[model samples]
Target: MIPFSLLDYVALFWYITFWLCFSWVVDHSRLKHHNLSHLMNGHRLRWMRNMSTRDLRMVDTAIISGLQNGTAFFASTSLLAIGGGFAMLNSTERAIQLFSDLSIPVETTRALWEVKVLFLILIYVYAFFKFGWAYRLFNYSSILIGALPYAKTADEQELEIAIRQAAEFNSLAGKHFNLGLRSFFFSLALFGWFVHPGLLIVTTTFVGLVLIRRQYFSRSQTLSMHLLPEKE
Candidate 1:
């Protein structure tokens, strides 16, 4: 395997590139509605033709949410893996201490380290599944948006149906991604704690700030209401 320093640089590079690409996809998707419409035919074309204003709003929110969750998962996991590797290298004594705390035998403790490696692998796997599912949900939302039934009467019933479907889809996608991001962040902190409690405290503080700012103060999210009106 590559050295921890090299791995950190690779992770940082991937995180930046993924963030930029996600942003571009969101912006392009919003601006290229006509192209998207043309690209999709038959059922998809008909659906878009029928979609209500509420459905459009929901679709927009879903796309933005998928991007947010996806970015968070990528960035957090990369940081965790790289940071964990460095921590293990610089703090072997501490790693042993942390891994051997259980009331298990010496043989068991050796096995436990192996298990910890597997645990970390599982965490990444879970994160990837969650992020992948979120992406699929957003894709489904886009398909639903395209398949909206545009009725001339524009009854309250139809609007309600569209809004509810869109809202639920977005919610499902958001929840999965949020869970994944949480897991990634917490696991990183756990690794840091083993390296040094002080480092764990710093990571925790930074993670908390990022979470708060993203939810309530980020430029895109904070002003989302004005940019894209709610369905209700």
Candidate 2:
């Protein structure tokens, strides 16, 4: 095992800490008024409200089905990625030789390479769990939608309660799905660590900046805000 240098340890620590802080800031911080997530949350609520008024709920069900399908797809992809990671671990000798031939100056022993591959596997495992749970939450949201009283029979208050319940579950599912996607993005950045600690720090910082921009300043956020109804 090639023992990790102090710099390697520091790089790994910073990568994990930054990821956690970034996720918390994006999901919990309300400093921004019209970030991508906030805008989508508003739309989720509006969608529930619109469904409450409709007699035919096929559209709402179809949307929920779509969400479930997307989550399932990602979960399956994560599983495949995990299997590939194991396959790479079994061929570490060839991988190390390939990196050497490519002139990548990474100082990796067999044990260290295995550890790196294991780290990658753990990341995909985390994503798979997140995606799987999100799929289940979407299913629960669908059931909630179905349980909602028919438009003709439901009182306004009853409809409001059902809509709120369904919307909350839908929002929670979306949050988990987003987290899974974020893991996928960060995994790409993690590949830099296999090259060098310095490169890892640089890639991590770059990825963080890109994610922050997409969340708060992207054109999609602008378009979503534009679609919102104006206040009186």
Best by lDDT: 2
Q: How many clashing residue pairs appear in each of the predictions shown?
A: 8, 0
**208-228, model 1: which lDDT tens digit per residue?**
556545544566453443433
lDDT of each: 0.51, 0.88
Off by over 4 Å in 2: 229-232
| lDDT of model 1 at position 20 | 42
lDDT of 1: 0.51
Q: Which parts of model 1 are misplaced by more than 4 Å?
A: 1-116, 151-155, 225-232
Q: In candidate 2, what are the lDDT values of residues 25-114, reduced to their tens digit?
A: 888776445678767877888888888778899999988989899999999999999999999899999988887887557677788888
Screening candidate 1 with a backbone cut-off below 3 angstroms (N, C-alpha, C), the clashing residue pairs are 47-146, 47-147, 47-148, 48-146, 50-148, 50-149, 50-150, 51-148
